[model samples]
Target: MITEFAPAKVNLSLRVGALGEDGYHPVDSIVVFADWGDALTVTPSDALSLEVSGPMSQAIPGGEDNLVLRAVRLLAQASGQDAKGNISLVKEIPAGAGLGGGSADAAAALRAFNRLWELDWPLDMLAGLGSQIGSDIAACVWSQPLRMTGRGERIRLIDDWPDFPALLVNPGVSVATGPVFAKFDEAPQTGAAFRPQGDLIGALQVATNDLTAPACAIAPVIDDVLAALAATKDPQLVRMSGSGATCFAIYPDEAARDAAAGAIRQVQPGWHVFPIVFRGVSAITPT
Candidate 1:
């Protein structure tokens, strides 16, 4: 049996562009992974089978439509290999919290199956196959901090990224990505690319999530969550991570982040407040 980790994705900086001729949305954003996320295990089997279990597993579908299954099928067909295995998904990331939970699961499956089937494919090769399953899959395959553009197929690794501490808070609500993009198109913004400043906080000050406004329109609770994070005495920057509902605040150090998370949890007990150290291009270590 082989086990692979599916880290929760967080868009440290997301900039959405106009709809493309292919009917896909162009996006430029910085994606990060959380050390604490879903996990998947794969073992050989005569037939493809899947079992889902975890804190957030109930919210995920256990069928062919699941991204994990689709990823396996796509890779098998593309590689001309038999797609037979027993796949188990242990979901920890929120389903529709703009955390790229499903995408990460699919990426993890691809990674596991590549080795399970002895494909010995590299990250780029696996990411190419992942794009067929979903746009986010390509980015999730790397599971690191990188710039995603051109409908999320483009991946550029970032350098000299500061190790900022982050607090991710979800107001126990789900925000669908499709609707958020649709709303953005209804009344689009200038939608420009992110320009990095000398410092992380400086760069963050200029970058923003284009889908935040529309997302708030769809789910008012998202606005409340943002306000709550913003109220934190003095966070470096507070904004919606992706689309909506799950907002993050970057701090100068881990101590500050933990304090902020604890204070928010005390006030919004129902919210899912997580304190993590943002290891850019790496995994977020939980506090």
Candidate 2:
């Protein structure tokens, strides 16, 4: 059996532009991964099968629609091999919260099959295959601090980013990405290029998510979550992640992040709140 980590992906900065000819919105964003995420285990099998467990597992689909199986089958067909496995996922990240949880799981499966099937394919090959299925898969496969643009396909490393201690809160609502992007007012042809300056943390202070407002418009609870995070003591930054529903607050220290989580949980008992460290990996971990 082989196991791989599918870390929660966070968009530290997301600036979306107008829709392209392909009907996808172009975006300029900075993405990172967290220590908190799902785990996928694969074992040789005659056919593809999957089982999902974990606090958030119930929210995921168990049928063919699940990306895990899709990724495995796609890799098998593309590589001209009959790759089959029993993939077990311990899902920790919330779906539809803009954390790229599903994409991360798919990427993990691709990495797992790359070894379990003895393909030994290069990282780029896996990434290319991943892109066909989801926009975030390539970035999640890399699992590092990336400056992502062109609908998330074009990626470059953003080095020396601080692993800011953060509090992620989801107000028990899922916002559809399509509608959120559709609601973007006067969407431009493309977002301006991002230029990093000064300290990474300080640079993030000015970075923004253009989808935040549109997401809040779809799910008003997002505003409440943002407000609650703002009330936390001395937070460095509080903002909505990805599109909607899930929001994050970066703090000066781990203590601050934990404190923020506790305070929010006390009031929003039903909401999902977690303290996480945003770590960046330089390469993929294949097992």
Candidate 3:
């Protein structure tokens, strides 16, 4: 059996480029994995099957259409290997909270299958397969700080990014990415090009998630989360991650993040909130 960690992804900075003729919006974003996420285990089997369990497991689909199942099948087809396997997904990241939970799971499956089958495919090949599943999948497969563009498939490595402490809060609401993109009146046509300046943290401070406005339009509650995070006692930059629902506040240190998480948890007990460090990989242990 092979086990892999599917770490949640946070869009540190997402800039939407113009709507393309293909009806997909191009994007330029900096993505990072989170400490909180899902776990996937793969065991050889005569048939392909998936069982999802964990705190957020109930929210995921168990059918063959699930991204994890699809990902394995796609990889098998691409590599001409048997796709039969038993995949167990232990979910933690909230669904549709702009955390890229499903995409991460699919990427994890690709990585595990590559090793299990000895396909020895390069990471780019895995990323190409992942692109068929979801735009975010390729970025998740890389599982590092990257500049993503071209409908989230184009990836360029970024070096010298300093770890930033963050507090992520999800209102437990699913905001569909489609609707958020639809809400954009004037989207970019050309891809955004920019160089990282100063320290990684400093560059992020100047960057922005272009989708935040449209996402807020689709889900008003996202504004509340952002506002709350912005209102924390310590000075922090609050922005909506990904398409919607989950928002994160960047803090200077871990202590500040912990204090912010505690304060927010106390005030919003019903919300799914956690303090995490933003790095290339998640700090949370995979189930």
TM-score of each: 0.95, 0.95, 0.93
Clashes of 1: 1
Off by over 4 Å in 1: 281-287
Candidate lDDT (C-alpha), each: 0.85, 0.85, 0.83
* Separate clash counts for every candidate: 1, 1, 5
lDDT of 2 at 104: 96
lDDT of 2 by residue, 1-287 (tens): 98888989898888887777897878788899888899999999998889899988888987778888888889999999886789899988988999999999999999988989888887778888998888989888888888887878877877777677898999889777878888885453345656678877788788788888778778999999999999999788888889877999888899888888989989989999989988855545543
Prediction 1 TM-score vs. true:
0.95
